[model samples]
Target: MTDAVQQKEANTRVAWIAGVGASAGLGAALARRFARGGLSVAVTGRSRERLDAIVAEIERAGGQALALPGDVTIESELAAIARQLVERGTLEVAIFNAAGATRAPTLDLSAGQFEAAWRVTTLGGFLFARAALPPLLATGRGSLLFTGATASLRGRPPFAAFAAAKAGLRSLAQSLAREFGPRNIHVAHVIVDGGIDGERLRTSAPQRVAERGPDGLLDPDDIADAYWYLHQQGRSAWSHEIDLRPFNESF
Candidate 1:
């Protein structure tokens, strides 16, 4: 290849964020954060419209972004995303933020419901990491970040299914970190310890939002900032797991 082409490739860095939803959600915030930092971002989710809207917003802010819509639970889709990322640019960061779980009584939670939660958060994370690692390894320096919840550490009432799934994901992140850290890959699991102040919570539990008062809920942008910080850390000081919560939130 010509020197000009080589230079172009060297300058191009990409960050892939999965599970993007609302424009005000954490996933969208992550995409915008990485893009603002000069890394071209590729966002994926089941909703093409949502992904496109996020891409547009990023572009409007003078950042490059592409929408690669697909279900995180599908193995085939993740493999295809890997190929697309390779074709697009050097993937310097890959974040698995897909979460699938619903609060229901233990008796009401069917086996299928329990498994579905695992498939989306745990299984999907495995597939995404498997697919993303190749490109990341090619770069020889990449960061894989997983989003976890308070459930990752404890199972509360009505959230048994969600807790189990997040716990599994946490374990997965740990294993990957142990195996990949020696290879120069940074794997981190971020435990979001409080309710997020975003579209989902605001729409679903407006009353809860009010009860939290100012700075009670975790800000999506602040969460995104944490991810960004993790990705930028030096190898010697790398952190494998971190918990984020509001100041007033109990541990």
Candidate 2:
């Protein structure tokens, strides 16, 4: 291919995956994948120091990245980030991966705990979608993908707070998909059924690590590859939801 054509092909691809939580071992892996593909990335989280560190790692590996620190629960922050990205240029894809979970018996869960989970998982996803709509519409084509869990599809004991929040997210994803599909924007959700290898598993509950099999755990790179595939789908054949689990994982 001609140099100009090759450069143009590279320039059109860009992705912004939000939420680099302690459990988001997948986010860093995904960031590396996108960076290797020559896409400029923006990684956001509540911790500025951690975000900066992730940016540094990406850059050191010859990838371009910007660390955007903000809480998804804050509407103003979401708006500002959206505006900043729009000002730079088109945002071809956006992945809402920020999630919060509270494991407790349903009866023991306090009002505050329930609200907090909702704020992070459900409300945060809503706010991000609302803030990003205008710019995504401006591009005339884009993808909005959410990271979900098995709780979204079914409720289980000891996870009332998290289950409710994830269920709400699933509903939101479906509603958005229907509302925006006609506008050429793809809205989808991925239900990750296995544990991710991150700080949480490494430090808090090493025994749980075996649940994801001898492969260690579902790598963020694998999940990121799935996101990339969803983004590339045609309008007619778009998939709205996908459930992924480690090979050794049962149920």
Name the top lDDT candidate.
Answer: 1
After TM-score superposition, the amount by which residue 169's alpha carbon in candidate 1 deviates from its true location, in angstroms, is 0.3
Off by over 4 Å in 2: 1-13, 22-24
Q: TM-score for all predictions?
A: 0.97, 0.91
lDDT of 2 by residue, 91-135 (tens): 888888888878888899899999999999999999989988888
lDDT at residue 101 of model 1 (Cα atoms): 62
Task: For residues 159-239, write the lDDT of model 1, one tens digit per residue.
Answer: 988999999999999999999999999999999999999999999999999999987999999999999999999999999
- Minimum summed lDDT over a 10-residue window in model 1 is located at 3-12
Root-mean-square deviation per candidate: 1.3, 4.0
Where does candidate 2 clash, by residue pair? Answer: 26-220
